[model samples]
Target: MTAGILAIDFGGTRTRVGWYSNVLELITREESLSHTEEPINAVIDRIIQLAQKVVPDCEVPSAIGICAPGPQAYTGYIRYAHTLPTWDNIPLAQRISAAFSNAPTFMENDANLAALAEYQFGAAQGADPALYLTVSTGIGGGAIIGGQLFTGWRGLAIEPGHIKFPAKDGKIYSLEALASGTGIGRLAWEKLAASNTPSSLRQIDTVDGKAVGEAAMQGDALALEVITEAGRWLGLGLVAMVHLFNPQVIVIGGSVVNLGELIFAPARQTLAELLIDPLFNHENLLKVAALGDDVCLTGAAIHAQKMLAS
Candidate 1:
């Protein structure tokens, strides 16, 4: 029987688990809804269930690799998790490893894992230094330098969302607060409330990021305006990343990407205008992630394989 690996990508709102062969090919998949209110044990159980379903009965995976929301695993304690509050101070590695009957578990930050996946198999392929940004419920970033995931001594590096910058409102806020999917929705609602401008967005009872995207796709002026502002803010954040890391490629992904150029166009233009070095402005430097939803999970599988080799 071929050996397999268990890979888990745990997020604040959902968890994804997959089985992969020792060579890093996915065999099966499962997902579970996660909650900050639920006990951490419950989430572990869900992961275990998925693992069992995917792996063949005779082949208990060679190893297990987990990619979870961070700052975590530095000292085997999750300092504080904003997405899943119940995970705060929890011994994440030990607990997850125990659930699989002590199968060797390797852990890394989820965004870092995603970046690794891209570098190995997706958009950042062939690029030695790359940057990956996920702009969904929140913005998360990871960097690959010298063909390795770049985590600072404490594993807190590449947290792009937390970068504080001034917005049009004259207040400095985290990049996520101004540019994520959630942020895009917030911007639309606040602007709609302040302006009497007639638009289809006002007809909806609730305006979320998806709603805003849909309205913009339909040519609603108000929705388009909100997206443009959000894209510009995101562009500014990318500028900081470009200057700091000088990556060969910057891969952007997540739910917000589905909105298409409503966000990317302005962000790209702004990024080009702000970058001082002409060498950094190549058309291919910034790209959409190629692996889509499976990027982080694939990274986990790759990590497991690495552990087995080590």
Candidate 2:
């Protein structure tokens, strides 16, 4: 009989649970609002409740995989997560293992899981060494080398967003602080407010990265200018990554990428200009991740299967 695994993708806003046969077949699925403000035990209980509702009478899963936002422990304890306030220093893997009567459990940073999903089954499938980046509210990254998740030293190594970038004003800030979806919005708001440009973005009571992208798409000159600036910063970050890792491919994903070639085209152009090495200038090496939002779920399932096999 094929073994079944339980995979959970726990995010700040939503919790998705799936029972899968191997890593690909979704046997059952469930989702619930994530009460990230609640205590870790409360969240775990909710996940257990959802799992019971979905699986009902089946034997306990062979193993469980969890994907959570991080600064996570190398051993699978959650040190802290920006999205979930109640999860600080929580021994999540241990708690979940106990909940299942000591069934094997594995946990990873959500970005790492997403990267694994792409590496194993999606965009990076055949690439020996690939980088996966998610550019949403914040930028997150993971790397796969020789088909294995490359967690260096503390298992906290692949944080690309924190890389520093020199701003035009000479202040150095993290890539996330300048290039993330939220960051992009902040830049546009600051620039638009300071300028006399008549923009539709001024009509929105609240400024956000999506709004900026939409405004740019609609021919708002200021929005387009800010996004182009953001693209340059993003490309600078990618150049640093390429020089450091020299991966065979880089896969970009996340909601901000929904801006499509508007964002990527400029980013690629900047990357080409900045990467002086001929070997690093290949256009085919950088592409958007094929897997959409489902990557973490798929990745968690894959992690669980690997754990069970080990």
Candidate 3:
């Protein structure tokens, strides 16, 4: 039987696992959101159990690849977790590696893996230099230079969301604090509260990002305004990235992209206006990620395969 590999995409709220082997030529996958309430050990155990169930009997995976949230230490332990607090300082790679007969396991930031997926199989395919930015609850980004993952000096590079930029109010804020899903919702709530501007969003009990997006979709003027403003911030961030990297393509994904043209339209407009150098304005430079949710999982599988081969 051909060697098998296990791929895990561990997120703040959910975890997805996939089993792959050359002999099967098909991936068996499973997902669970219940992991949020469980401890780190419990979550890892559950993932291992799921992987065993999916793998064909008598076949052990040669390696496992994990795509996790960032700020991991040099030893592969997460120093701190802004989303999944329970995983803070956990020796995730060591524990997961030990659980599987001491098989080698590789881990990378989720956004970086997403970019790798896009470069290998999604929107950035065939693009030598590309940027993959995910504008979700919080923004995260990764870069591909010369068609390889461009992890920075300390492996914590390309965090576009953390880059400080000025918002409309002239206050400097990180790109994520200004344009992420949560940021958009915060803008909507603040706008509604600061001004008497009536909005359908006010009727919602909670003014979260999804509610704001939904309100915008329903043609609420205030919600649309908030989204547009957030787009401007996103555009500003992209402009900086473009100037710095001159990427051939920028692949955008995440839950917020569901707003579609409401966000992209304004972002495109702003990007066009802000770009002073003609060298960066290539046609079709911005595209949505084609691999969708499976991008990270696919990347993890590929990474695991490479690790096992090496």
- By lDDT, the candidates rank as 1, 2, 3
- Candidate 3 lDDT score at position 157: 87
lDDT of each: 0.84, 0.83, 0.83
Off by over 4 Å in 3: 22-26, 73-75, 168-170
**Predicted structure 1: lDDT:** 0.84
What tens-digit string does per-residue lDDT give for candidate 3 at 1-310?
4568888888877778888774323468988773667777887787767666666676667777888887563246776656876666788778777777777888888888899889988899999799999999999988999767888888888889998976568898898988999999889988998988889987879998899999899999999999999998898899999989999999999999999999998888888898987778766988999998888888788777765667
- TM-score of each model, paired residue for residue: 0.95, 0.95, 0.95
State in Å the error of residue 7, model 1.
0.6
Deviation in Å, model 2, residue 106 alpha carbon: 0.4
Cα-based lDDT at residue 273, candidate 1: 96
Lowest-sum lDDT 10-residue window in model 2: 50-59
Total clashes in model 1, counting residue pairs 3 or more apart in sequence or in different chains: 0
- How high a TM-score does candidate 3 get? 0.95
| Candidate 1 local lDDT, 1-310, one digit each (tens) | 5568898887777788898877787879988776656667776677667667777766666788888886774344665667766566777667777766788888878888899999999999998689999999899988989877888876789999999997667998999999998898999989998999999988889899999989999999999999999999999999999988888899998999998888999999988899998777778877999997778899888877876688
- C-alpha-based local distance difference test score of model 3: 0.83
Report the C-alpha displacement of residue 63, candidate 1, in angstroms.
Answer: 1.2
Q: Ten-residue segment with the worst summed lDDT in candidate 1?
A: 73-82
Candidate 2, residues 153-189, lDDT tens digits: the string is: 8788789899997777799899988888999998998
